[model samples]
Target: MDRSFYSRSSLIINTIESTISGDRVFTGNQPDDFALAGLLRNTKTACLLGVGYGGAVRAMLAGDPSIELTLVDNDAALIEFTGNLFARSFPGVAFTSETADAGSHLREHPGCYDVICVDLYSAVGYPRMVLDVGFWHDVREALTENGRVVVNAWGLPEQLSPLAPPSPQHAVAQAMLAVWQDLSHLPCRRNTTFVAPALTPADLRPPVDDASTRLSYEDHLTLGLIRLRGASAPVLLRGGIGDAGQPAPTSRRAIDAEMHARWPGLVEAVTGRAEASADFRAALSERKLTDAATERLLLEGSPAASFAPCIASAKAQLGELSMAWYGEWLCDEWFRLKALDPDWFRMSALWQAVCMARTPLGAVWPWEARLYDMLSAELLDAGFADAGV
Candidate 1:
């Protein structure tokens, strides 16, 4: 139950380990932020709904000073804390603190935002609004001329959307197909959609400046990487929306196995393994995580050799992961420290207050948020977000 115990630098290593060991890494499912960020021109303004701990808000503010930001979160305390923190980090950009639902806010300001994030972690996977058909409709109205929306999720690629593209995540893969067909029929000026993981070279057509305009080759590659993971949207557990179903640890093992099968070649390529571990720990050992030469191999073979440094960047994540892991452990150690020495415990918590790691593959706190933020933003920084996107 100690989150930190399991979240050490090793945890960060796990994300990159898959790729380092040469098994499957990136999942070809890019993180939300990286993918999302690329959608904006450098000077674009943006809004981050559900600011939670403000990771995405912080990253957005730091990465693009020109971007105007309005952060919304239901937690007043969290909103205030993150707002103030980011205010100091980004003094010039527009920063608004609104205590409201994501859907409701968008409804009030239609066609105004360049980016909208339907992130779940701030809600801890409970964005009830997404479950409603009417909600997505309002979201459609919320976009600016060339706007994009990213629904950050914790589900695996296959489970990202209910059945999968040409599908939805409501039920099984079949259910996804049904939903996609229905969604395709919905009123819109040619709304395009696809699951991130399953998008193939052929699936994404280049975006036409006008619907009839031919898409550039670069645009097609970008669009192709943003598909929802797997074949459909991730399946919601039996009860509420956003709650990942605990299908028993055994069930999860089975699911992870299925995930392994989807793209053996890519996973192996990233991890350099014949077969990835069901345990993942075995695959992500520091031996692999710290391989400085790892990126060299990837760089030697690809035209994207410019991305080689990312493997090196992934190494930076280890330190952040270590800090976050320490933070999590520190949180649980309050009582222990109290017994030994109150002063020591206070210092422990203070140390955790600062996590300074730029790379997602190494960051201690789950880089999932950054992954989504950068993915949503669409920056191909050679991290898992790059592969996943």
Candidate 2:
């Protein structure tokens, strides 16, 4: 592993990358950092496990300077470096750095923290304790009555297509679910941040007067709330469709039928609207018409006449980019119709499009990400009939 540090604005970003793979093993100040900070808004004392460059520490302090944080890591040098850096950056915040294994620290200090963040990772992957049910029990025991535990687990399959082979994160998620009641996981790109016992929207709201942190807090809270929708239960439960304990969908028809049963007429209506818009655009291109001429032609005879209501309803409901992506998905689906698995087409296509449209800077537009979450929630629901632990 190789470590590097950089300064951005007022924050110092510490990153560790894999020497062999050259991929980031840990990086501070990501979206997940802000999300965790929002969760810790009202917390007084918190413990961070696997203090990789103190990203969470910086974020939590930024959100609530009064938070007393304890950083635990087995690496003495890393702990010392982080401790010294924070001592300079935040002159008077209450925090401590201890060089110790996270599990041992948790066992020694049961019921000691208001919030506990588990972010143990290495160049190889998540440590064995992360996937151990017994470790999770220790985590539960360490929390106060109303205390919350958030685990930063990576390599989770996307929520929309939950059929991938289970990763280490899946095992950790399973372990957490087994140990804690009301656990919920929020998927952000390839990482899924798991919190337990479940949090409500009100629990994640930003402080009224903290305008500087408001946008980041709200963005994360929006994702958190979207994950709370009832339809997200299955993906949350199994960590994807075919993990160890959950049964697969059986067949494409079964998956499609389930989707229709959950949200009747929604898929049909949206697809129809997209198809209508695509046809209208094709006609305009064929005629080589200006906007004025297109309006005159529409007055003569509407190209999307049959789907007028669907088009109008979709336009009213979806944002302009969302509608455009919806049409783009429809066009791609047409070519894939013969080879498409219904589940893949119905659930994953639009999601893949959203992922592809992410900005050059690697950030998804907030509204587009919200649209994906809303659409995904409507397309799938709980009750995977043979899919229980």
Candidate 3:
């Protein structure tokens, strides 16, 4: 087949010509990519996982100038390379890329995306973490209200082997099922390029498969749906919607108080400021963490070499532009500190600073609690603390 012929819409056949030359030689877009573009057509803010060759990026940009894209990949080199490429290619498009583990990224930056597209893959298949229920839980938390997570996977769901034997396909379906179950309370739909057990032929209509293309969209792709909820989950989500009893309070102070109550000793460990502490007493008349004294104290200490810029960016109060600059500083510091040694105490202080900078109101965010839980898990794993059973 010619190089153009190798550009199959379904990507079902991996031809030698296509394999050697790769998608770069393809003339037209794959139908799956087109469908992905369609899914993102109305999306103003989007998070894309596994930005392999910018196929989906191209499709996403084809829609509108209003699109704000955050492309993430675990590969740093790939992130830098594609980030620069897209910055140059789509000059007007608001785009950014980060080299991060998707699960870790979602956990740290919660409730940020309008649409999250998961297409992560490895040589063996999807990465082990991508199949994790925890990853989906994080994804669920990170999505905005009215947001939808469309996972791109191969094969039909029911046709895959069941959970008992744990085949690769089974694992993929299980992950999708977790997503489906998590959003079961909301509206959900699973779409496949080929006819799957989940969808009927009648549901397959119109532009999804034009007469010109006549391609089997069902066999090519499977999208798992998880509709975002407008209201936050219960004050405590044990692990993705389990035991969600009480309604979360609407007020900021109430939320902060609830967090403090749920995780005792957390504020002191995280912020280094306890209500009974001398520092807390001194700040009784102030805004506490956001006060000038706290900022001065943070800068007074010798921080990591990479953290100097973050310390430099700290101001008593900031204007809009300065606030944006401060945010950039915090993002940079978070990445740098995360890469550094596991000095839990030092890291906790730095992490708290980043969290405070990110949230101006001083109300603890979901990500903050998640971060503490992550640190606690690491500490427990390292034999530093009680298993707390």
- Name the top lDDT candidate: 2
Give the clash total for candidate 3.
8
Which lDDT tens digits does candidate 2 get at residues 54-157? 65554454445556788899999889877776566544445888999888999999888888888776655566677778998898888887788877765533
Computed on alpha carbons, the lDDT of every model, listed in order, comes to 0.36, 0.47, 0.38
Pitting candidate 1 against candidate 2, the one with the higher lDDT is 2
TM-score of each: 0.42, 0.53, 0.38
Backbone clashes per model, in order?
82, 1, 8
Q: lDDT tens string, model 3, 1-389?
A: 11221232332213211111122221121223323322332456778787765545644433233457788888887677666644544333357888888888888878887667676654344455755778877887887765667555432111111111223333444554555533211111111211111222222222222212221121111110000011111111123323223332223344334434533332233235323444432332333332333344344332222122223222211212222333333343443434443332232333333323332223323343344344444334433332111
Model 2, residue 152: displacement in angstroms?
0.6
Best by TM-score: 2
For candidate 2, the 10 contiguous residues with the lowest summed lDDT are 17-26
Q: After superposition, how far is residue 78 of candidate 2 from its true place, in Å?
A: 1.0
